[model samples]
Target: MRVSGGSTGGTPSGGDGRDRSDPQAFKRGRKVGQTVRGRLLAPGPQGLFWVNLAGHKLLAALDHEPSLGRELVFRIERLEPELLLRDITPPPSAVDDPALLLAALADARSRFEAVLHRGPPLFAETGAAGPNAPLAPLAARKRLFDWLASTPEAAGLYGRLRELLRLARAFLPVQAGRPVYLPWAFPGLDASEGLVTRSGRTFTLRLFGRLAEAGRVSGIFSLSMNRASYRLSLERPEAGEGLVAALTSVRLGHRELAPVCVHLGPLAPAESGGLFAPLIAGAARPFTGLRLRV
Candidate 1:
């Protein structure tokens, strides 16, 4: 969702004094049977719960009291007389299951790779040409959502990937230590950020995605306390001299920074295999007494 301001407080009231903050009215264009993601805000009067769904606060009656500030997923059961939501959020134990984590990581990697192969341009603009350039992270996210609207399937995949990543970040410590995956605006592009080796101030990140025009692209970005720089490696048929030419003059604001672009001949598997290597390695270890039957 696009960033917005202001906070909603107190219970909303209708003319008849009944609570007016019904979730049905603020479904955010979602229909019944569709799942909506929200966070548990606080308990309301009369045993109702206040929830923040898509930036709007609505009241819901829950069977069990979920922890405050916990993200929840609910399927819209009804929208007529009253809005009913079924809590579909997975249990913490299930989220921490190695099998589930591996499946999620594999699914995300495959989906991202598929999107990179056939989806729209990763960036609104490649910043290949001078003047109008690629957007910053936040603006890029807005553009990404705007692009995803036209492609519903892609948007759904993005939502699932985002949820899985969030769950992984929250529940899986082994996978979260290094190469922590965070949500990126561009579909199929897994971006990870962490501190550089032996350096507290230097941070590094890598982005992998495909451009409709550029085939497969991998980018590495390094940022220090003051300076930032990036290198983009491309793998496309028939050579990308023109695309490279356009990228040479890319700008990140008013200041022009030199970005290195390398041609890696043909793309090599997109690095999806290594995305969850650590998790897989951890999960594959044999238990103390576990054995397979012949």
Candidate 2:
């Protein structure tokens, strides 16, 4: 079960007849036998997968159903006919500790929040002007990406942010063959535009995030053109419930929209189950879920 390509060509080289060392080569163009790293964003129609390859979205055929958000290194198996990638990422070690993975995720989230705070103001006040305006979130994201490029220590967090941005981009509605840009009202917040759906004449934009308050807090904000709803789950439920009560009578403007709902409960369990789950189930199986006709 091998993925075929043009040929096992020689190593990529420069005009000087020496191997090129440009770190951004993958972004320029892919070559057969060249290795590239990408994160699986989501599944597409016909068993195809949407992969984020060096800031570019590409549709790829896989041999198995890869878990979403999984990062893998792939060798460019074929460039013509259809882009095929052979997973070359090494499997999780038998001694891999799930605790360490969880800790890393926590650290990444904290670092991401810190970066967001120091970079720019995420949300605009009612009458804010200049830099803190409604478009600030878009600018802030770009600045954060630039900062991540220069700060090597935040590499893990960078991937997570990139993944979130990719997810947000995926939800953008296309019009006239171009995506319609929806400005992020909360400007600099570290929330992903989770979903967008249209039914009848209403369009809804959903945002999701977990922030550190009195411990970690998870929230979902669903906004329509005329109304908004919020669902927040906090570590300290009583405090959040009190806050929601205080804002219950607050009006956004002259119009009274739908009532906002808040839910308080325990944090959802981690998706990765047992410590040895990946080891037992095999993390990188040959993708056989999607079949392509040549």
Top candidate when judged by lDDT against the true structure? 1
The true-versus-predicted C-alpha distance at residue 147 of model 1, in Å, is: 8.0
Candidate 2: which stretches are off by over 4 Å? Answer: 1-35, 38-103, 111-139, 149-156, 160-215, 224-226, 235-294
TM-score per candidate: 0.46, 0.35
lDDT of 2 by residue, 1-294 (tens): 022222122322112333222223333566654556767666544455555666555545677766677676665555555555556443332114333333333444566666545543433332222332322144534555565445533433445433333322322234212112222333322432234455554444433333233233444444445766766555555555543553332123233345377555654444113112222233333344797899
Native-referenced Cα lDDT, model 1:
0.52
- What is the per-residue lDDT of model 1 for residues 4-95, given as tens digits with 9 covering 90 to 100? 12223445332233434645447558675566888877766666766787666676667788888878876555565556655656555436
Question: Lowest lDDT 10-mer window, candidate 2?
Answer: 175-184
Task: For each candidate in turn, give its C-alpha RMSD to the true structure in angstroms.
Answer: 9.7, 14.3
Cα RMSD of predicted structure 2: 14.3
